[model samples]
Target: MRPQDSPTRETKRLDGRWHFLADPAGAGRAERWFATPLQARDGVEEMPVPASYNDLTTRPDLRDHIGEVWYQREVRIPRGWAGERILLRLESATHRATVWVGETELGSHEGGYLPFDVDLTDHARAGELVRVSVAVDNRLTWQSIPPGVVEDTDAGPRQRYWHDFFNYAGLHRSVWLHSLPQTRIEDITVLPDLDGDTGLVDYAVEHSGQGSVSVQVLDASGAVVASDDGAAGVIRIAGVHPWEVGEGYQYTLRVTLSSDGEVADVYDQRFGVRTVAIEGAQILLNGEPVYLTGFGMHEDHVARGKGYDDASWKLDFELLDWIGANSLRTSHYPYAEDVMDYADAHGILVIDEAPAVGLNMAIGGGIFGGQGYTTFSPDTANEATRANHAQVLTELYQRDKNRPSVIVWSIANEPESDTDASYDYFAPLFAHMRSLDSRRPVGYVNVMLSPYGKDKLAGLCDLYMLNRYYGWYVDSGDLDNAMLHLRDELGQWAQDGKPILMTEYGADTLAGLHSLDGATWSEEYQQDLLEATHAVFDEVEEFVGEHIWNFADFQTTKGIMRVDGNKKGVFTRDRRPKAAAHRVRERWTRIRGRA
Candidate 1:
């Protein structure tokens, strides 16, 4: 559902301090913790909402705790919100969560990194004290989307997964208590296209009750350029301004629903007039070939793990502008809605992805590993996992379908795409995505192990996204051989006649380490690696983009390979620029100027 507030809607943000408790033994539910106010209970501590509870304190037990955690807060509904439909909206609840309002269960959601709403109109009264409690589980299993397994160790229960990122869990986004009209507009779908010098906008609205729908296309100056009177129709505008790369031109589609000749609800959807298409070996935006130059980003920070911070996000965009980059991939999962909105307003392109990582068992030594088992076996990533993956794809499409910056939909990142069983598993998912929305192209990130010769799913993709660690994982510290191997691989992929984008290629370098001989893990080596990769990218005719492995340093599970966290970022964890950042700025600025 559309959660954006409008003229007829009111929302109150429930972000701040809340009483927190860790249920390591999983006794919260059996003890009936949600039956009363949590403040009345003993051994309760205060923690900040909209942030991960992992690194918020000094206790190691709390930092590395598994199982369930509880958050409770008291909110007083506004007296003016009487006669309105009140709803409790959780922007995100990591992994899984269940909600309660004074012993009465509201609802439960299974996925993380997406918004879900629980009806509160009949459960609580307006202008009254309402207690809200949430129980979130950080456990993952074979049935989970990004599948994982829990091992019973001598110390305690251990969570293991194949993904490189850390498992930062809790409420990592904002929560809201919003009010809407009883018979209000539920959803809006806007499709904008360019025709010669005219703009055509096709729209469809879904409402709860019967009403007459009226739509108006307004330009940037708030002038009505086109109008239509129906729930689903097309509005055409003459002398329209097409939304081009690096030019944030948008038109507002104002939708109003009327019942008995009176206005019931109004929603203003901001959209741009543009279209995405792929020619022979070129990715087109508005019928013009466009080059993508950016990095694969993560929703991570210094203390706030995967939490949304406005200041840090703004700084990231400023740095992107300084580097002269145009696009980025929401690596491994879909990012926050605020990030998508900023990309829309600032003219930065995005490749929206699903949380379908770590589907391979060979890397993580999963339960079926060393047993001659495939990744798509009945005991592993089988039908249940695929079903969950499809559900996330549906939710992702529903949430970001209207954003103009989202040009491509990436199904998964570095899945096991080489085996025939893997192909059988993902083929239907790719088709399912197309059935959901046929306007955008869909693809998956190919790992180095699944090269052009062995990958079976490459024939099914609209474009090829390759993540090769040539100089880092493959030919370590050998730039000459690395470039040769990279060129050979690109030549093999060019035979498919599809546009290729290097989604991830980088070396981990310490922030302060420098070497005159270009040794691995040194700042100079990172810069040299990038330069060498860029040289290969320019020589390939089918290459359309070059996105670095990571934008900044981020936290990960502790291992001998990582010092504190992954040091593959061009910038430090605190947004400090490294030597590679300067090299990238110079190279990308020249490329942008040439384009």
Candidate 2:
């Protein structure tokens, strides 16, 4: 599993310019673009693959578009892949996606954060030119996970969600055409545990056709440390070295599928032998207590929007290393899978989250209005939304269950958990998540409502992950009041007898603005707010962690309240440190020394 080693299966990349057309009126279906030849189409524009169509151009209309968008590309199948099973895999397409090859319909997927595949073996032929059409709908409805309403405004229709980030949509990740044998390895699940220095790995291999599976666990030096000859079983390696923060140790599990003595497919699943546990209000890693420190980040940037940017992430890691941070919460949603892999390789702790943001009915009315609003329930009783939420959680679990970097699973972010209906909605989800993976602690990023009101659903989580904007959102510019409020809330939460992580707390600072009196949108105000919160943290014994509100500035729906997106990042959108960054670096460095 080195970068230089080629994959056993052949893959053709389809990640360049594709013919794009905005279908606000839903005319693409009436016109039958899937059945029509590309050459005969009109009004088609070229847009890059793996990019958010919102940020790809200078057109304001396209940037704020909220409807179905059509993308078409022509690809030729390799002759060698004729007899093999062909599949079109998209790393992600926002909201919903319908795919088609020529006149044949391939299937559609609902969720946007996880990968989806369409089997093309029956619809496509080798060495032939095939037209692939993808229809992506970015509109949000009340039934969506991040529930919102489409309202008719002066500017046609506006798409708004309860979340505080821009709804950037398109093919935000890579797409590829993979060719595999008919009897190929579908998936591999590796659950690693530790018995002192020895590593016990419980594994299961899934396949398409009947086969005998053999697994080999290779150590860091490419030495075979353990082996098994069944599709489902466990293997143990003596003298195993556990993975630690900033140490980045990994082992490769090579799963070989053979049908009647003929090699069918070989797959590699990399994992780290580590254990995460919560023992009596302490978060333990490898049986040792560890405190979390980092930011709740987004997959966002100025030019790329929500599209996955490798350079941004590399710079982000460098910044995190400089800030002496060891962990981060994938705030509000699950990031790209490559991010999880990078965290595993670099030894950063992750709180893997789902795209379950905006499950609230109270917010989303332009910032100034939604303040103090009540009844923000995300209709957990709706059977369809609940079913979809469960499926999304299942997919998120299956995708990242083996990554050692992921120690916790965040089921939701700031949902309507203060009401009785909230309990009905979250209890089933909490149970489903627990049943899916028992290795990680499952919780939601509770909002300020949990502390201010009755947290009827707080018992659903193993840990209390709270998000509060006391000074900025409530008593503005009053650090004294903020400290008093934070102390009272933290004291209240500690009484629950659970490890508490102050998952989010920060002020929106316009990068360089200064204020002698500590007013809002000033660097001084942001610094003071955080310092006050940290001061309270020192007094609270149960405060296990504090992740800043944002890793960097990110886009959001246009509003007078947001000065060109949310500007709460310690770092600017260009990945440059603001004044608050220096204070954070200093505080974190001192904390790291004590740690």
Candidate 3:
């Protein structure tokens, strides 16, 4: 079944050319760029609105830009939309964003991986051209999630981060000016479950103005199946067709807000009826245990550089399908809503992750060897950063909670979970995530840390998601030694009596390189390492899944260790497969229906 677009009342696409200016000195606020028309300003240049400024030019300086950049554009609100509640919606902004409509300051939002909106109802009159200015800052500091340092160099203050990826900053997603009724539905939440033979849908809706609400649940044929009149209630169908893996079935939910028998607003949402549970060291999907076999992917490419592209989107799914993959973890952050929609329709499982990468306290260390033995402390685990981390998790959950494709939520990527501060910081955060959606399992991706007393927060996770690079990082090129260490570690973790997923394990090999001796950086070496890793995984019944480190190569912060970029990808950056791809396909295909 093809996925349908989200229903909306009225919308005007706000993409295309916009005036841009780099503000390295943070002079935008001082100069009051938000208070005046940007066209009158001198140093403004034309730039595409829904793109990263770093890759739009060939200049190396622009590609490595740090600090704030202003983007201003002229928009005309529809004349007929005067009585409607106008909203200026930005799909995503990098790091931090402040929006101004005309001279009125709408407000600011922190964090960049989620959407933000500004109500432009009182700021602009309909049928008039309004100046909209947005200030985006991509700088990172110790006080920020994914903490870093700003060093003053001879040229200027250089922005640096603890994360591996390049800071591709700007408005990296689409923007829109949409309209809705004043007495509109604020939010709609749907939690689907199986109640014996009946399909149960529990929902809660929030609205702004006083109005009587009627909710209707429609099946695939667009016929109303169940309904109720109120703000929140459950609607159950007599016999519900369950959404299964590799086979998708979805239902439409329409909520209408009305006063005096006239409909004031309508919100249309789509969801699937399914249940995800953990049954004694096994992950059960729709009451059947599933073995996850796929890769941890990134929203990355060569030219786009994290900017969303339709062609890449289509190609990605095609390749995944070709390689016989059933699932993938949205490795480091929540992906675009459309990506989730695609997965929901295609029946691909997802492990939604938060943008809490680089939370580890060890800033600089040896590339392969462990960092100079540091632990999480109050300096890196302060209240402000933790609060931001919590907020990002909330936004991520709220934005993607409806998608049935997402079976698990990964809170952080590679945080320092082996310390007392880590336990203190993640205890409340993990509780919050589980509270938001109890239907799905929640966990964090643990790095190369000892679970024997060192990993204090292992109990907090429903599943242990380990990212181990034994042959690649620890033992260098010796798979026998790597497998020996892996077996001992797995044996230790199995004592906890919980399911585990090798969330990341792969050797970085440049495409087309071959060596019969199986040396590092060769395709044969990568395949051999994966074969050894799988052998250990096969021996342990507690091991449920394994997602190779990366689906493809992606750009990273400049480092001597990287050859242009990280080459751990089973497929090259261009989506072409290496020798490991054929091996993975054969393995996944053989165990497709083991349950």
Top TM-score hit: 1
Q: Per-residue lDDT tens digits of candidate 2, residues 1-595? A: 1111124478887888888988877888878888875446666788887788898788888888888898888899999887888889888888889999998889999887778889899988999888999999888776666666677899577776778888889998888888888888888888888998899999999898888999999998999999999999989989997888877799999989999889888887899999999887889899998888999998887777777767878889999999888899987777887788889998999999888887765556325344333433343327677788899999888888889999999988888787877788789999999999887899998878567348887777788899888898888888788788889988988987789998888988898799888889999999889988898988988778889988888888777789888888999989889888888889887877833
Model 1, 152-253: lDDT tens per residue?
899878887777888888998889999988878988899988899998888999998988899999899999999999899888989999887777788999
By lDDT, who's the top model here? 1
Q: List the residue pairs that clash in candidate 2.
A: 361-376, 362-376
Question: By TM-score, is 1 or 3 better?
Answer: 1
Stronger candidate by lDDT (1 vs 3): 1
Which of the two, 1 or 2, has more TM-score? Answer: 1
List where candidate 2 sits over 4 angstroms from the true fold.
1-8, 37-40, 153-155, 365-381
Tell me the alpha-carbon RMSD of every candidate.
1.9, 2.4, 2.6
Give the CA lDDT, 0 to 100, for residue 199 in model 2.
93
Candidate 1 clashing pairs?
none
Estimate candidate 1's alpha-carbon lDDT, on a 0 to 1 scale.
Answer: 0.89
